[model samples]
Target: MATTDTQPKRLPILTFCAGHMAVDWPHGAFWVLQPPIALAMGLSPSQMGLMVALTAVGATLSLLPAGMLSDHTRRRGPVFAGTFVWVVVGYGLASLAPDFWTLTLMLAIAGMGTSAWHPLATGTLTQTMAGQRARVLGIHAMGGTLAEVFAPLLTGVLLLYLDWREGLALAVIPAAVVGIIFFQARDRLTVETASAARLGDLKEMMQQWTSKTGLALVSMISIYNMAVMSVLAMATLYIVNDLGFSVFWGGVAFSAMILAGAVFQPIMGHLSDTMGRRKIFAISLFAAAPLGFAMPFIGSPWVAIGFLIVMIGAFYGVRSVVLASAVDFAGKREGTTLGLAFTLMDGVGALGAFLGGWAGDFDLAYAFALASGFAMISGTIALGSTLAFPKIQAEPAE
Candidate 1:
């Protein structure tokens, strides 16, 4: 029988982080690729809305099953490594898609790989570093953030010389390599699965998530995620179509947004680990609201990009903190809890993306305003929940 490696090794974590980096590469490119692909297919704004909605459909469908599997399975390395290859295949097929619906279907399949990643990867990390979950999860987030920051910039550069299809095809090669490496290193990275979860435990977990405080936390995660998806989808379109910027600038703008978050993530996570998750999470959402509201009005390319930086920096910075908070509330079934949170997040986000896209068809400003409203409302809910549950203030990760 294989024994668990109780001590965390640097190399294993690095391999894990690389796997995260590889799986997320395609997602990072989504914003930059959407405009050219829409133009190539002659898709209307409504069709673009449909595309965003559909992109999340597969993710929402897969997350819960993946989470349950992760919780029960002893060896997660195979599944974890497989998610990387899954993304490669999805993107490869997407590159060859001949029509709008075909491309949407393939991209949606790719989204599943990313959605499944969070529950398995993050759940294991939370268990491993149960005491310092926010900090470790923050580091894991940086790996994905690095890919998100570079993938679009790289795709933008590729666009100058190659078609979007070729750019997507080229991305598959690196992800495939990472998958193989992860497979080879599976022994080192395998999660020591918790004792087999029972049906009663699962049912109890569901009840906890639906309780009053649990409902408040879920509301914050879902509403905030919806606003994030809407803003990102609309912001990408607004930059390329309304502002008349090249795809390169669109990539730069997207990278700026992610890079800012990357810089703030570790800081936010450390603060939350010491300061408590609720305050940090609520503060970040509140800070982001005004910047998102201000984005549509800015006409200058550089200023608009600057706003993207600060806005996303605030929200995405605390993302892991929010996840860590949910795990704290879960008290058990960390993987399943994360799965439910992500399912709600992506499900609501899909609807918001569709609505934002449709609103963009009439006026891009409407999309921005709508997104701002979401952030504002989310911040209000988070603040209210924190005040109502004062005992939860400064709750420890353990």
Candidate 2:
């Protein structure tokens, strides 16, 4: 039997963070790539919407199963590592897609890989950090923020010299190396193991979800993810095609939104350690709500960039706090709980992606306004959730 390593805790955590950095690039890369691909293929807005929608659906399929495996094994390395292999294959094939649908299908397959990453990583990190889960997850999540910040901008740079297909191939290079490293190092990553998942495992997790706090968190996660993902999926397209910006500027806008979140992630996460998830969670949604309405009106490129930074940053920064709340509510079976929560959050959130596309067809401005409505709704729901379950526990966000 292979035993886990007793190295400095940061070693494995940093290693895993590296893998996240590798995988998340493609997700961010798509924002920049989508507009060019849509124009090149003459794809409709609905088709673009379908691409993101199907990709999200593909991820949803595996999320629950992967979560179950991670929870049962109490080891996230294998699952974490395996996700990138899928990414390599999927992105590699995606670069060669012959048509719009083919490219969409390839990306959808890759979504399965992307979907598997978070729960295992976040769950394992939550378990690993123990008392400091929120703070470190902020650190780990910063890796993804870096990816979101760079991926779009990098892709824009690549496209200046290469075709979209070649650009995608370049993106695959990082995942291949990371996959090999992660596969070799997987077993050594920290996780407290037990028997595999059983029927009772689902049952027990279900019981937790039924609680006021759990249910409320689920709502917050689902609604907020829907809102944010909608923006991510369309921001570049909206910027370039609708707002009349250059590809590089579109990428810049997308990165700005995430950059703000990245900058704030560590700060807010550390604060949440004493502030409590609820206050931080609610404040983020509330603060971010109006930015959605403001999105369509920002015409000046510099102004638009600044607005995106604040809006996306406000919501995106709250992710670690919300996730920490989920982990606390989950107690021990964090991988499983996170899986279920994200499936609900991201799976349902996928529809918003499609809606972003569809709404854009009618009017890009209206689509943004609709996204704003979701944000406002999410803020309201989060506030209501706090009121309903005031005793859920932890430091107050206020």
Candidate 3:
């Protein structure tokens, strides 16, 4: 295993963690306000859905390239720098948008920023704590979950006190600070940890998709992402438009779900680290399916809110378990493998978001059912793949 003997103490990990946290904040904040933002901008629900889709588009486009770049450079500086700048620019553009076209372009740029972060960050985390990949990834992933939990609540509060533009502008500050930390920690990043694998090497990796465990993990990721995106993008709309809830209550519902997930993610990750990824992965998915299916049936607003909390919590908790399985299957080339799987899964999931919006427009209950079906698909994939994958044990640091 490669080592970063000369790297600074803990600053690199701390800074990278902060950057991860900051990137997801805007996503959470924006989604909570999406319905109102669409109304305020005079856009249709489908058009608003497209805006959310565009971010995934940006992320999907960048995933493979970011992984390749991280492998070649072994340094996270460039990735973090690009992500921070593009996110800030994207938010600024979103703030200044005069029409849907401008907003679309802005989101596309922001999507690029969002896209750049994961592969590089995941790669860095894997490298930084080589042997303890699952635990570290869990810790890193928690940062994003934390942001998801807070962004909607903060955005709602800011919107209550100030305008959307002010709220968006305020959102950029954290990214800027994250950027500074990334730059300061540049010296601590080890270039060798970035695999010297060329594009040709990645091509060879693509050929290894014959591995049943790898394929299964990827399949599970796809189903899970589809379910997650569908819910995140459309839940607020359902609450606001169909259930007769105010935007504030809608935001609260979104926040509650995220908070539930945020609380459980680290615990799930830790369990995956200790109890075996497959066991936890299967349990989470199986539990989440019923919770998801039941979401739209509860008529009382508070009951619906409570159900969402349980549903999203189970969804994100299982997500960590599934992602850890990727590392388990990838073994040596965790970055490339993780990146490729995520890109494909999330790309397909983006389509799920579109379907969700369409479903919500017709019937919110149907949309919830659709998400539940995907969760069931994910659960099945996890159960079928468990026996095929090797048991993963954390490696001792070199």
Best by TM-score: 1
lDDT of 2 at 315: 76
TM-score of 3: 0.90
Q: Estimate each model's TM-score.
A: 0.94, 0.92, 0.90
Clashing residue pairs in candidate 3 are 74-194
lDDT of 3 at 150: 76
Q: How many residue pairs clash in each candidate?
A: 0, 2, 1
Candidate 2: segments with Cα more than 4 A from true spot: 1-11, 74-76, 393-398
| Candidate 3 positional error at 257, Å | 1.2
* Candidate 3 lDDT score at position 143: 77
User: Using lDDT as the measure, which candidate wins?
Assistant: 1
RMSD for all candidates, in order, please: 2.2, 2.4, 3.3
Q: How many backbone clashes does candidate 3 have?
A: 1
Candidate 3 structure quality by residue, lDDT tens digits, 35-80: 7677788765666666666667666777777877766775556667
Superposition TM-score, candidate 2 onto the true structure: 0.92
lDDT of 2 at 204: 81
